[model samples]
Target: MRWAILRELAKGQSLPVVEIAKRLRTAPSAISKHFSVLYHSHIVNNEHGRYRIAPGLLSADRQSLDFGCFLIRLDRLPK
Candidate 1:
């Protein structure tokens, strides 16, 4: 689901919830969970009720956390 969001948002344009759901072939509610998490995690941003990939996330590297996914960090290099 997140991968879909990433792919869609990779187009370098902002999208509203309804359009995003349409592109992804899912219900609005179905994708809302991912949108909320992604927005809160700094992976995505919302403005005027539309969403776009956060610039910081686009420029930064990411690491996977085996636990406590609610935690996100920047300025850390992977070993």
Candidate 2:
């Protein structure tokens, strides 16, 4: 799911939450949670509520680690 989000943003275009939610066939809230994780982890950048792929995140080395690292970070949050 996170990979799908990254792939869609990898096209180098900024997209709003609604558009991403539509493409993923999920509820807006579901996409929002993923987006929040991505944004907080610096895997994606959000500008004025629109998200764009961040620099250096599309490299081959970052492929699967991004989501794994993101999950790790989420676990550390004050839950």
Candidate 3:
């Protein structure tokens, strides 16, 4: 669920924590918890009051490529 929220935020230019909670239909505290996890993992970053994907995450090229492939497969499945 945290990964889902992170991916959604990744698509956005940037998002505030409140806005992210609204979009995810979850509590702000829940969002904050997941945000903490993502922050610790260095997958997402907090800038001022907004969140964005961490620039350094791209250094894990293999993992990114694997995730892209997984998304492609998931997209092909029946909804």
Choose 1 or 3, whichever is better by TM-score.
1
lDDT of 2 by residue, 2-74 (tens): 7677766765579999999898898989899999998897878989999987765554433332443543222
Stretch of 10 with least lDDT, candidate 1 = 59-68
TM-score of each: 0.70, 0.70, 0.67
**Residue 5's C-alpha lDDT in candidate 1?**
73
The lDDT-based order of candidates, best leading, equals 2, 1, 3
Kindly list the per-residue Cα lDDT of model 1 for residues 27-70, writing each as its tens digit.
99988889999888777889998998876555333432222334
Query: In the order shown, what is each candidate's alpha-carbon RMSD?
Result: 7.2, 7.1, 5.3
The candidate, 2 or 3, that scores higher on TM-score is: 2
| C-alpha lDDT of residue 15 in model 1 | 93
Candidate 1's TM-score reads: 0.70
Q: What is the lDDT of residue 27 in candidate 1?
A: 95
In the range 10-77, model 3's lDDT, one tens digit per residue, is 46457888888998788998899888888887767889988877774432322231333343222223
Determine which window of 10 residues in candidate 2 has minimal summed lDDT. Answer: 70-79
List pairs with backbone clashes in candidate 3. Answer: none
For each of the candidates, give the backbone clash count: 0, 0, 0
- Runs of candidate 1 with Cα error greater than 4 angstroms are 59-79
